[model samples]
Target: MRKSFCTTAILLAFGFVSSCGVAWSADAPLENSDCVKCHAKVVHENQADGGKHKTEVGCLDCHVGGHPPSTPKEDIIPQCSMCHSGEAHFELNNCLGCHQNPHQPLHIVFGDDNVAACNTCHPAQVNEIKDNPSAHGEFDCSLCHHDKHGYIPDCMECHEPHRPGQTYSDCITCHRVHQPTNVTYGQDIPNKDCGACHGDLMDTLAAGTTKHATLQCVYCHKDTHGYLPACQDCHGDPHPQLMMKKFMKCTDCHKDPHDLVK
Candidate 1:
């Protein structure tokens, strides 16, 4: 009878606190920044400044309305749909799951977030950036995609332009969005995946006298994978200087610059 009376007393106390709008914590869970310390710098690398984390908006402020497990990998973070009521995008698809980190929140490189995301407005480089394996694989999608849907970023808007010979008239010529690793060449630029576009180049390597014939175009065009070679850089006497001067344009004599000495 005494134990039952005590249980009733505890229930009445809990209800009174609940009715008073006061929260009862198991213990005060760590604030957002405190969580980041042990969680490492993996969550929000970009929000170091006056953004969400710096504003003292803790993890519980955003990761609310869900019960995350005690384990790290097993912890299911609350979806953005929970408290991101102020923002709007497509439907939720475990955004933070595939997206991985939220602190940097926009650098998606896996599927089509790279060159193509920018191409919704910058259509010029869409196809080329999509094909280059080296274009999208290395970087984060949010690095270039600073805006939401259909928003275009000027080249200098987010990043600086190129130098002397390296400047790209079309960013897609060398820059890819989806996977920085898969780049395609342009119209003026001869395509040379060796197997994909330059099957002829592969055939020559297969039946050639030189061992180099066995190599792919990308093998020689290393460094920046989307980059091509200048005939002037390699073989000193690759062609007659006098004839080259008269032509002014190398494509006239070379047919396809990638084909070379045909």
Candidate 2:
């Protein structure tokens, strides 16, 4: 009986070893020591990358929580920032309010649907863009204003520094975001509205007697953007304006100077 029992025990031990060889292989798990040495700085560095963090936060930080971090997956690891509730910028509603992406979150893009958020930090710029028909449209304001707390980028900073030949700093002069029609100093103008800026020239025409008097100044002036009108555009007379020096401009003899003052 004793001999039979020994044989049965030997067979059972062999069966157990065979079963262990067939189990699923796990990924090369991270050793606990490998994670502890540089955990905090890794988080900071990860956040620095502009893309949604591919790995800003480590498993130990999220999965381990307040306790000393362990590599064991079963340790009480937290998954999202909301659990802390005391983290800086935490009150910003969802974890994404300021930290847009969890994997590589550093950019603070202004939410297009939430102007109130941008207003909290950049009220002045917000107003300029909102009130001006030519400023940034629904595109997120932070798309250009990349920094935090009202950080506006100079147009030349992101674009090539204005070349020496460039004459102006008014980026708005051409980059009308609301409607990007390339309005240089020479196009897309409204002449009737010229009176809005040049009241004196308009007065001279309202009192003229010629075909020019019949045609509103804007009819021929068209939209030179902001340039002055040239007589060469309608009347072939290069001398018409110079005539003011010798015979008086065409307007003096043909159009009214005031109230059609003939």
Candidate 3:
């Protein structure tokens, strides 16, 4: 009886082994084969919109192990830092919060907290906003660039122009949107651009008969906004030293540089 029981057990174990081996051999190539066959959607999207991810890397580079049913999910879905390490942004634990799809990494949609991630790449723009805080600085980076990366919002979408006939190009001429109050412009800026904001001051300067009337606003204001140049900067003590000593201030006699009479 014992010998008969041992023979039956041996046969059952051998049959099970043979069946498993046949199944593995039949399906092995398909199972552990090209990823695109099963994950076609992921592959397609990655190819179309993956940005640097598609161009720089491949499926096996990230997967790193056996495919699907043979491989555990944790092994298949890699941590971003596995490849993107050594950077400050890579140190962030939850990459998926902003970069929702690893397959298409640059298809980013960020919330308020995630906006700071922009500083990782756009440090200059972030610093410009920090150095000169304004209404633009109060909002997240995504607030303006809501569509995707590299999108520049129309200023008119949120702000009315200072006056009629002003354009998007005109707004940027005097205002750096990141640092809106730090209004600086090139010499090419038209007097009309300045007149849009300082109409009264422009009128006062234009109405005068002095040499100041012949000069453009920028000729005196020079390179920066709200910059006050000393009379000595150009004229170099228009009065005698004795008269300068008594009068002390050029504005005391000239009244206003914009509308100078004498």
Candidate 4:
């Protein structure tokens, strides 16, 4: 009985020590050198252009548990959401489809339905499209940025220029493409671009001998498209207050700024 009790005690002590050894090995940090031996390509690619992943975390931080000869593939490979969560885009299950490599997350190639995911980072552009919608806003972001991120598509790809010599820059000068209808431009824009739509008005303004004919459309239109500036803004009370009372509207006497007879 005494020998049996001693044998039982030894087995229990051995089991306790074995368990401690396993726990210590599991808790130990992985050696980078060992990881690189098997995953040289992944490690190299990550080191080159891993963005925040390379700078912020080590391989073991993501890969977690045991490696080859011990851990299963399921145990070694981490889900993107394990570290990247909370954002609307991160909630998407198939991050690898566009991102391609976890090592280089920003090396993206857009896939179908991926354009909506852009709203996660570009809320301002999305909101601009939503609030002031146009034909451009109706289409997916990928339709314009088909190649990659930060690509600016030429307006001519989808629509003809407003005028003969108009370039892509000219289109954006007066039109916010995301909300194309909300046309606004700086003072530098020539009268010809505006004349594309207002041809009759342009012809009248050009034929007139008045000082208004000498100015650009932007001079009176000022900040944005379709803006009709008040005569008082430029010609402040041309007659007297009593004379102004008789002709409340500037057009009553001027006929029209575009066709001023005087």
Per-residue lDDT tens digits for candidate 1, residues 1-262, read 3334334544664432231212213354445544433344544464553254435455566555433223343344555665565432325344654455565555443444544434444455554544555634355445555434335455656455443233345556654445444545434332333344456765665565454444556555754654777666665567777867878666676554444445
Per-candidate TM-score against the hidden true structure: 0.29, 0.31, 0.71, 0.73
True-structure lDDT of candidate 1: 0.48
Ranking under lDDT, best-scoring first? Answer: 4, 3, 2, 1
Write the residue-wise lDDT of candidate 3 on 25-121 in tens digits. Answer: 4345433235554356888888899887877887777877654445666877887877788888887757887788988887776766644688888
Can you give the lDDT of residue 69 in candidate 3? 49
lDDT of 4 by residue, 1-262 (tens): 3234324543664432333332224455456655554357899999999998888988878888765435666888888888888878787667888888889988988875755688878988988888996877777888899848788889898798877989988888888888888778899988888899989888899999999999999999988777889878987876878887877688887799999966
Could you tell me the lDDT of residue 136 within candidate 3? 82
Candidate 2 — worst ten consecutive residues by lDDT sum? 16-25
Give the worst 10-residue stretch by lDDT in candidate 3.
15-24
- TM-score of candidate 4 on Cα atoms, chains taken together: 0.73
| Candidate 3 ranges with C-alpha deviation above 4 Å | 1-27, 30-33, 50-57, 67-71, 230-232, 237-262
Best by lDDT: 4
Q: What C-alpha lDDT does candidate 2 achieve relative to the native structure?
A: 0.49
Better by lDDT, candidate 3 or 1: 3
Highest-scoring model, TM-score: 4
What are the candidates' C-alpha RMSDs? Answer: 15.2, 14.7, 8.4, 10.2
